[model samples]
Target chain A: METSCHDALLFTAEHPLRLRSGATMAEVSVRYETYGTLNAERTNAVFICHALTGDAHAAGRRPGDKRPGWWDTLIGPGKPIDTDVWFVVCPNLLGGCQGTTGPSSTNPATGEPYGLDFPLLAMSDFVTVHRRLGEHLGIERWAALVGGSLGGMQVLEWILTHPSEVDNAIVIAASSRLTAQNIAFSAVGRQAIMRDPEFRDGAFQAQGTSPDKGLSVARMMAHITYLSEDGFQSKFGREAQSGELGHNFGVDFAVESYLEHQGNSFLSRFDALSYLYLTRVMDYFDPFATPDATAALAADPAKVLVVSFDTDWRFSTEHSRRIVRHLEGARVPTSFREISSPWGHDSFLLTIDDYHRTISAFMERAAA
Target chain B: METSCHDALLFTAEHPLRLRSGATMAEVSVRYETYGTLNAERTNAVFICHALTGDAHAAGRRPGDKRPGWWDTLIGPGKPIDTDVWFVVCPNLLGGCQGTTGPSSTNPATGEPYGLDFPLLAMSDFVTVHRRLGEHLGIERWAALVGGSLGGMQVLEWILTHPSEVDNAIVIAASSRLTAQNIAFSAVGRQAIMRDPEFRDGAFQAQGTSPDKGLSVARMMAHITYLSEDGFQSKFGREAQSGELGHNFGVDFAVESYLEHQGNSFLSRFDALSYLYLTRVMDYFDPFATPDATAALAADPAKVLVVSFDTDWRFSTEHSRRIVRHLEGARVPTSFREISSPWGHDSFLLTIDDYHRTISAFMERAAA
Candidate 1:
């Protein structure tokens, strides 16, 4: 496996970024990491986009880090992504708290954290940032783009926004647009953060406080959506945590304990305001809303592969089907397969032999 | 349709009741409503159980109310349950706040509201109370027992604990036990309430406060689980509430507005403590956990019908399948059917023709 190191790229005032929400920000910077070597033609570069709550650290371990990166299972030299065969680039999206210019970032104009003042983001903005990052890395055109969930949404944006930049695009466990249920979940999560007294209108940083409870609640809710009912059954199965009920409002079931641990651990690594902004961006994503939308895009048939998990109710197989249907209607030769898995929406991140094989074969053919 | 009126049934100290959690209460009171008349042979009594957040008012409206009961659609004179033909009884569950003895009820020992002091409950406790109500009504057994969700759990208890009393049991969108996902959601909901400072260790009432925000967030999270992705898309469809994105955390999408409305409206009608207690009872329900569980039960196999909705992910059709499997393993004659609908877990309460027909035909046969 090719070892990777984190790198930061600064987009100075000259590269002032304008967001879809009619807001603009200057001095943008994105943190990214890369593995393997870019070919002489720069045609073997594979961009790996991260989902919500993910970062530039897609694979491999950071300095002194005992645990490997989030996507280490699938992104190593001998793994499905096969870093030895292709240069893999993973960038933390804008509005992310992980070494990216987000709400926690200082506003050049005010010399303070952007907080609520941070301009709203769209998936296109992330793609735009990625484009700048790609240009900085001396990659004019890449071999392929791959992402799952929010990252998948970004992959779609990259194809629609800059079709000629990549040869193949793989969207895994994502939707063309977030459905009402997705938005509703995001809404509750945002409301939970906003209603937390410590949230303080997304400016809790000034008070040196964190909306830990609200953010924990949000993560708890989301963590449930990421697992299948079968997964939950096989993992927790109504097992009591303390051998006896607390007989009060305390953690009684093993699932509750797991959720609390997930929620609490998330608070240590994530920013509450960024959770708000990023989830909103997902809710606002819809490419086909414009007039002559699909027709207006650079129609490149045989350039897209869509994948879904059978048990992924969060962004179920139907969502992937809808995306494929949209691509087909636009005359794009799209290949889609719903892989069987009990991991729900998180199947893309897990080690499923069939899932890995499909992705490997697809990537191999795309490279060929 | 025959007009119905609400009635209260009180059990004084002479009728002291013990609960499954080793807690006992005196002067326990259960509110109920009846439609039609008990048959001459006392054999046509049909008991309808309400799920979480439900009450004794299962059908018809109060004296001056404009809206009918929640289940009024299927419980009317000429409707599916056919109140005109069968004697129908609906009682508020023991841990419910709808004029029933619950966390909001006054504690005989403390003389204050039970609140956190209220003992935890199990499905059997609700059944025991209903049995007392039945004895009070001079009805030896019910011709049929029908319920959905938590109500379905209670119906299972009725058959398992007092098998001879329920000639027919119909479980709708229910599970024999909650899976990890269900418990995770309930855990988040409970944490939302408990973390609210106003909850004050469940003594909010004493401080003249209500954990409205926490309770509301709980409701919002549960509401998402109650609807299918298709149902949400058709209903809300990423429509912007203000004609444009607020670009802030304020209600931007129509789904957010709708969920906020639901959460807010729920606050006025429900007690936070009751929500906590009832959800715990649901989390604790598991009939097959005991040794000799199936053989110990007085097995009357020919009297059970398990109904599920294809789109109900909260208590998905798989959960219903599990219940049917258990029943079959116990040599119980059970009919299981999965009806297609886009309403998700709420299909049982919606105007789905297939769902209503299944229940109607099953109940009719059960009564005969």
Candidate 2:
């Protein structure tokens, strides 16, 4: 299968977009990718939300691309999401760097990259763009909104803010609210980026430099949280790169080399300002903290499926349990499962038998 | 009830110290603090090893100092270690910054700070300096060697390398070998410090600048691991610093402010080069990986007590269990416990009833 990115001007100066922070964006654009085909009734559309560091490339590959989409394993012709039977639409959420009007985009006023000038965004802002994309595609309601991690946060936001438009919501490895530890980690990552001399207060492009070092450090640290301890041990257990300790500051262990590579490669594709803004979105996410936050679900409630991985310490099973309890309390039809997987938070993207089966079963019922 | 740091020259050109990495240090000075009087026989001496970022001041307030030592809660006159009965001696380890000869120390050969020129060190090197300090204090054998985290690594090394000099060993929240995840965190921290432009390849001191930003970022990340999720949740659960989200790059959550404080406070007391070297010591520590690494214990075993906290995901109870298994395999007398505490790895330094009782009982028996 092949896939190509498509960009659309979702909001223009005449129709400025208002954000959750009470800030307004004069113009907004969305980059998205679609697979399979929309049925005549257009009731088979499934919206896929990407996680942190993820883009709109949910499956297949663009021409000349060496690797398939990040979640290619689960979205092929005969696979779980089964592209043959479902029209999957994945978009780069607001405040993203992947062909979206984000921090790296040009500001009409300054005619330079938005950089730090970009308004701080919230999950609601992302859902706002997603909803626009849905309307732009002429879809009245989504058959299912599927996502994990930050993407999962988007799904929850969609169900809570626009319950009438979401027929089914699948939130995998997400949290209704971030734990203190989660916020602490995100804060440190932001510190790494902002502290970099090259960051230059997020205007590195004008300086002809990038905060690669700081961004790399942030990515490397965050990557560790995405994988399980068991997964790391099994993949790279104190294995010396040269079969002996280097006895120096260089990479001695295989894990060190792996992390260094992860850090370095990330610099080529990600933006520093976008990272800072997106992580803040996750930090401030507390949809349930507001009064009657779930009250919208009481009427045209979306069927919800919350899935968590047993070894995913990042979100953990408790995060899923909390989501289930809240939805159940709101009288929303909800199903929950804690899938056993050693891949950690990254498990959501991998091809696990039970995880795929659970999603497949849920998608089949939702599409019907 | 009072303590003062004392510096002593432990090695000189005429008597250089050889390191496990085949390098040698011509001049080495150790900084230590002693509490209580040593018995006439010197058999009451108990060596205390401070963890990473800890100094020689292990208990009692130095004259005019505001706070007591880091472990003051468990080292008072009637405390667990009981200064009234044991002559507790705590020394700043090699590759440390607390008044010890380390990367910050001037090199006699060049009349400049060693910086990156400081030879890479291992756990064995830390043990060598510690052993020299014991001899300098005229103590033939320590009644017990107690330490936690990196300090705990020192305790394990002392027993394994010089079993005859150690009567008992108390290793708390330590790992016999770091898992890949542990190494990954350390690697990211080193990357953060090294990538700082002010770091100037670890020669920031010579350039009249400091990598305070990078060091602070590293400290903030490490501080999170030192604490348990529950501890963080109860202490700073998504609480806004100003009762409302700033919705900007500044500190928004209470946890962010708390971590920023931790990162900033650490800058005044810690050195980046020392952090790098000390963490490397942990990465290379796998005493039992070598053939018959514990062979020395068969003849002159040090009774061992390995303790782990239930919430210490940094070095979980599994790590302590591994230590116990290794000791028992070597026919060494060993006791193990997983104390319930919300403090995580820092639990080893806190005042927990069962934890203190476990240590007091073990120390009492060791002294007897």
lDDT of candidates 1 onward, in order: 0.85, 0.91
True contacts kept of 1: 0.85
Question: Considering chain A alone, what is the TM-score of candidate 2?
Answer: 0.98
TM-score for each predicted model, relative to the true structure: 0.93, 0.98
lDDT of 2 by residue, B228-296 (tens): 999999999878899777777888889989989999999999999999999988988899998988899
Error of 2 at A199 (Å): 1.4
Tell me the tens digit of each residue's lDDT in model 1 across B33-54. 8888888999889899999988
Task: Evaluate candidate 2 and give its CAPRI docking class based on DockQ.
Answer: high
Q: Give me the TM-scores for chain A across all models, comma-separated.
A: 0.96, 0.98
Off by over 4 Å in 1: A1-9, A38-43, A242-248, A291-302, A328-333, A366-368, B1-10, B39-43, B242-248, B292-302, B326-337, B362-368
Against the native complex, each candidate's DockQ, computed on alpha carbons, is 0.70, 0.90
The candidate that achieves the highest lDDT relative to the unseen native structure: 2
